[model samples]
Target: MSKFFIFLFVIFIHHLSLAQSVQLTGSVISGTEKLPSASIQLKIFGNEDLFTYGFSDEEGNYKLSCEISQSDKFLLIAAYIGYQRDTLIVSRTDLLKQAIFQHNFNLKEDKKQLDEIYIKAPNAVEVNNDTTKYNVLRFTSPEDRNLESVLKKMPGMEVNKDGTIFFKGKKISKVLLEGDDLTGEGYKAITKNLKPEFVEEVQALEHYVEDNLLKGIINSDDIVLNLKIKDKGVKKIVGSIDAGLGTNQRRMLSTNLISFINRTKAFAFANHNNLSSS
Candidate 1:
């Protein structure tokens, strides 16, 4: 009887291991051409937790592994510069030995016209409005160093020493990344820690949030900061190092590095300050 029980336990363990080890293989192509360096992210559907991820190589090929249960559904997100985002759904049955899936995408360029047309009773009026647009480059420079420092130089924008951001004499109530909140400590943490190079554009929205009853209830006085990141910017490696000495015998060194491949982004930061030597 004991031998029979042990046999069943061993079989159960083997099946469990197989269930936890699953592979996802695919290639990213843009308009029939391979798109090297494209990013891929995998996540359990309806769950914020990240699953396994991988990036396309020089030949636009990628593979990933994830521990999946029978009930877990998956969502695969692929993105690249100048290309529209692509998402795929995977199921348990999709897992077969060395299964290969092919994904091809076409990237569309974003273009807009600056002129406006208005129709009147007898004629149409064409107006060209000179609008001021603010992009991350317009407000940031290599000398600014960090996101907080760059925000201070933006017109009608301010950042307090405590890391609070304000615009046009009104405190910004919310900050969003690709329209999603940053989770905890939210904007405060992002502005203080994120490198300015990751930012692509800053859009100022007035009366940002609206409820059914609050229609036209202008919070125009209130502002929200929307951070738009470049599609390519998130998938590349970026970092910085700074070391300096002051006249008062103070020394400082700092370093920051970030890398994104596929849907995975990793970052590291360190700083050191010393004034007394033994």
Candidate 2:
């Protein structure tokens, strides 16, 4: 008789646990569009202790089973990236009265998240102090062979037929190679010859002053272009060569080579064309 009583007590406890458990079902949507992979979470209302969690299916349907305690209320939350989070308050008494509680989330687009995306976009331009930086890879394509080709596609910048660059309707005074004034006023020598693949960033400096002593004393209106090269290795070699043979045994050849090792830089260029005004 004592063994029978113990068995009955075990069955009663199992039934009590089942009676205290509740089922929660919901669907996540944005307007009429269902939001798949949305996260669903349930927590105690007052102390905010997590009780259960699940994720929506491809059809945006979610179901959660949680055990109810003596707490009077609980919180249900639905969340997704790029969308506003939704929360619902549920009562323990109501959960026990009904076997399943139904709720739906109508999430809205989050403007703050959109703003973050705009700032982090690949083509996003950034201006810090007097310098404006451009991501070289953003405006460059596979067809682009030289740095000049990428500059033409950048906004607020233009390249002339002679390979001169202009920024914001003002002619750039000079182009700097890795912060060093190597080419001086004849920047086309580097801009036209350097490969776009070797460059990582292009920066434009406003009111550029070449002399360090006259930096704050002299007020200048000059725009300068700076090329930031990519770090490939301790020593990097990048260049291209083109050779063509036309009619009458006419020949054309062009070659360019740029080398950067540590703090040293070297550039070499050669062009020969036999096509002359006959």
Candidate 3:
């Protein structure tokens, strides 16, 4: 009898967990035309990467399942080839209480060229939902190679040599490139290698420690940073090699190769012999 009761308790807990999952159904379309295939993401408040992924079928319909807890905040981001990415924020205290949600997305075509009419782009700071954004091209000069230089121009932001990013005298949690942490490494990898020319925008998330929902529950005070990179649609291989020979039979060689292809980025290094690196 006791064993039977334990089995029933386990089944009940499994059902309870399943009941907490949010079932999301949506479609991706472009101006009344359904996109045959599309990609979607659920972006959590504080984390750099999306919480989950969904793919649209030939009918442009997609379904997603994710776990949601009380006070958790998130947004739906959808993307398609040759189209601009779209984001929809779903944060209603009452609506979140439900176990399922239905949402749809519309992606705009990525127009390559614009009309000859002179129209200025937004080159200033703007705030959207929970994110504060700055267009790097509009705020800084062309000669800047690293983001640290431009970040200094933003008010209440401080960049230190020790890879510390401070906003309002408070250190932030993480930094993202192209909506994802391409490299698990933190700010140093980005501020040093990413050039200003490729950056589309710099986004700062306010008060999103451990993904907003958890932060609210735990009373955290960490911020988040995101960098949006433009897709140039070009693949190229770039690298350099150096070889040296000295008097005391000393030799040095260093080679580094970097590749940025479609949807993939890779870096490889080859080192021969012991060389003093400072």
Candidate 4:
């Protein structure tokens, strides 16, 4: 009889502990659109330390479970790239009232306006009307070899496996190098070969019109990307040459040269390789 009573007591304690655990579920959204891969954080109301962290699933749903009963109050923070962060506070009374809580966060799109005269505005992201400009130098890292690599780090931008670029879930029509369409639809010629250091700004043009005269007159929803080459990098030739000799008398040589002078853009590529030994 005593053993049976002890077993029942253990079961009761386990159940009580489970009841005290708090589970929070919600969706992080931006204007009715679900935001996936959003960051979620939990912290005590008065403490600076983080209690737990999690990320939203592909459907923008997040679930957080924590032993928050001991805490008088706690805070939940939800954040996504290019969007404003949202926060919610829960008191102990709220937790005691319900073990499973439902809360949703609606994050707004973040738009920034920066002045060029600002002293510390080097890394600023600015949005004006329908265009967004990203300071390439700020996002460029030593590991980034080409413009494509730097584009991947910008918000709302994606580079497909086939070298295609997209912004805001829409495919861009063309890529302009120094205000000129060099490759039309095939932009890989510039994005893949041009080094990141030579580019100063990347402008994302929405509702792009190919002709300037018909920009506002024509109803177009095409997106375009414009690369602004650095002043120092222009009017000068830049490229590399590679030559290698392998075993069995195999040899390979390749060279790339690029220059932009007075509205004239030039690019030259040459490769000579031997498939078999002579």
Give the least accurate 10-residue stretch of model 2, judged by summed lDDT.
117-126
lDDT (CA) per prediction: 0.61, 0.80, 0.65, 0.76
Residue-level lDDT of model 1, residues 167-263, one tens digit each, is 6456888766655555334577667766788777777666655354774664445566766666545467666788889987889887776555675
**Backbone collisions counted per model:** 3, 0, 0, 0
By the TM-score metric, which is better: model 2 or model 3? 2
Residues 1-278, candidate 3: write the lDDT tens digits: 99999999999987765446677887899879987546667766666234666467668898888666543567777866456888877763533567668778888777752221113253245545456677776546667746778887664466777867876456777777555555553666666655566667888887665453575576546577887766534585455566888767777876554456886665455556545652
Question: Which number leads on lDDT?
Answer: 2
Better of 2 and 4 by TM-score: 4
User: Tens digit of lDDT per residue, candidate 4, span 35-140?
Assistant: 8767677777987356666667768898988776466787888876556788888776686678688888999877651232233343335556778788886667
Lowest summed lDDT window (length 10), candidate 4: 113-122
lDDT of 2 by residue, 1-278 (tens): 99999999999997786558789898999999987667677878988766776667668898988678777888999876567889999888877888898899999999877765555444334556677778887667789978999998765577989988888657999999778888788889888877887788999899999898999899989999988877645688666687999899999888877678896787787778888721
Model 1 TM-score (2 dp): 0.39
**What TM-score against the true fold does each predicted structure earn?**
0.39, 0.49, 0.41, 0.53
Give lDDT for model 3.
Answer: 0.65
- Winning model by TM-score: 4
Candidate 4 residue pairs that clash: none
In terms of lDDT, the poorest run of 10 residues in model 1 is: 118-127
After TM-score superposition, the amount by which residue 199's alpha carbon in candidate 4 deviates from its true location, in angstroms, is: 1.1
What value does the lDDT take at residue 122 in candidate 3? 30
